[model samples]
Target: MLANRVSKRLLVGLQPVFKTPHVLPSSYLSAQNARKFSISSKCYQEQSPEPSDGESSASKKKDEGSRYYVPSSQKRKPLSRVTIGSSTDNARFRRASDTIEFSSWKAGILFVTLGTGLYFFFRYQKEKMDLQRNEESNRGYGKPLIGGPFNLIDQDGNPFSSDNLLNKFSLVYFGFTHCPDICPDELDKMSACLDILKSKYNIDIQPIFITCDPARDSPEILKEYLYEFHKDIIGLTGPYEDIKNICKAYRVYFSTPPDLKPGQDYLVDHSIYFYLMDKDGEFIDALGRNYTEETMAEHIKNHVDAFVSKEIREKRKQGWFSFLY
Candidate 1:
């Protein structure tokens, strides 16, 4: 009975050991699961902390503020700073524009000045060329072919020569006092021309009347006849040979009826022209019937204005265009 009680006690102890193994395994698994759950809960609480009532509302407000916040780099600048920078840029732009405008204005002025200068220069050159052409056309080679020395007697019976024509402009008209109507009309026209030239241009010209019919036109008769036309007129009459020579020198053509008797009433046809001579007794031009008194005066005035002194003309002859001169 002692041996049976020892075995039964031994079996009871072994059975308890076997049951403890199963219970220990179940409890260990439960403890492990509980530890894992607690660790997960702690980690979750750390990651997302639960807030109290007041803290929760404050946190929500902070989150909302962060959602709408803008970085400092993207923020708008202050009004005063922006205005100052804008004004600086505007000033730079204005300065650039002013510089361009000034440059354009200066260029325009220069261009206009150059163009005007060129225009006047060309005009002056053209006028000079025209004057040269007129002078060349009027002059002959060497001395003039129309004027020369002559001796004659005036209406006062005083001696006169070609030297008397020097130092002044002279008009020589070859006609007779007994010329029916042509001589008187031509003298009247010449007188009118002289008056116009003197009154308008302040120019004085010597008037002379050389008689082609010296036999009929004596000194006294010639003087009286010329007084009716112009008081300043000087009548000239010489011997037949001298009158013929003077007429030939002046290129005047006159003809009386063939076989005409002396002191007979007959008409003498002569050239009707006023010969214009310069200050040096050089033949300048001839005025024909085609020229009116006013037109004649204007023509003479143009010649006077363009007149150059003999010394100046000689000096110009020595210039680069001496051949042309």
Candidate 2:
């Protein structure tokens, strides 16, 4: 009985101490409580019996239906991503795709461009060759075969023919004296070019004026009219039929006015140009209204220089062959 009383007294004292508020900080009290709970839970688990194999298998089957439990094969691995988005790379990828898909388009464009270039190149070469051939023919190597045989009368009542075209280069003008402005201006230009060639380059040129209106410009009338111009100018006039034939040979165009009286004042329309012929009466070239006196002189000088140089070269070749022989 005494021992029982002692035990009851000890429990009474411990209960008062357990009921008292803790003097430790909240973190320290929490740590102490968690340690006590962990020790109690460990002892309880140790005392409990292990489950049987059947119970363990049943629990595993129940876990299989759970959302958290997935098969190894179906489990997803964490994705390791590398960001490569930028303007330059995006453009590069787009270009590569376009090139691959549109390779035929690119090839077709290249083929067209190359074909066009080659066509133009060959055409240009052909035109250049044609021009060179024409130049060679005109320079007397081969005959252009223009300015055929003709017979006509001069302003001084003398016979004129294609034979007169030889011994010197001829500047032939085909027009009428009645052409008020254009004829006078062209004649003045011709006279000025002749003066320039004589004074500047010391080159002599023969200027011949052929009338398209031979009916109006008689020999005596032409002689009187030509007296007003340069002394070096030679005037020519002939019957209408003869003049027409000569103009046709020169490829010159002229047309009379509408039907009217025989002596009526009318303008004869004609193509205007100064025809330059070689000493052999072959067509060299024509000078249009565009040529100034000095410019025409220079052009003539160039032709003369080329002719002289060609002659010199031919003489040298002949001399060399003779010496070799």
For candidate 1, write residues 1-325 as lDDT tens digits: 3444444466454431232223344544454345434433444355547534533433343333223333476443321211222445344334445442533778689889999999999997666556655654555568666767889999999988999998898999999988888889899999999999999999999999999988788999999999999988989999999988888888899877888776678877899999888787877788898998899999888777766656677788888887654
Best by lDDT: 1
Candidate whose TM-score is highest:
1
Residue 2 miss distance in model 1 (angstroms): 99
User: What does the lDDT read for residue 223 in candidate 2?
Assistant: 83
Candidate 2 lDDT over 1-325, as tens digits, reads 3444444466454431332115544654455455434433443355435533433433333333232333487443321111233335334334445442433677788888999999999996665545434434655444344466778788789998889887677899999988989888888888989898889889877888999998899988888877787887888888889899888877899999778697799988998989877665667678899998779888776554444233443575489564421
Clashes of each: 0, 0
* Model 2 stretches astray by more than 4 angstroms: 1-135, 139-145, 308-325
Provide the global lDDT of candidate 2 against the true structure: 0.68
Error of 2 at 23 (Å): 99
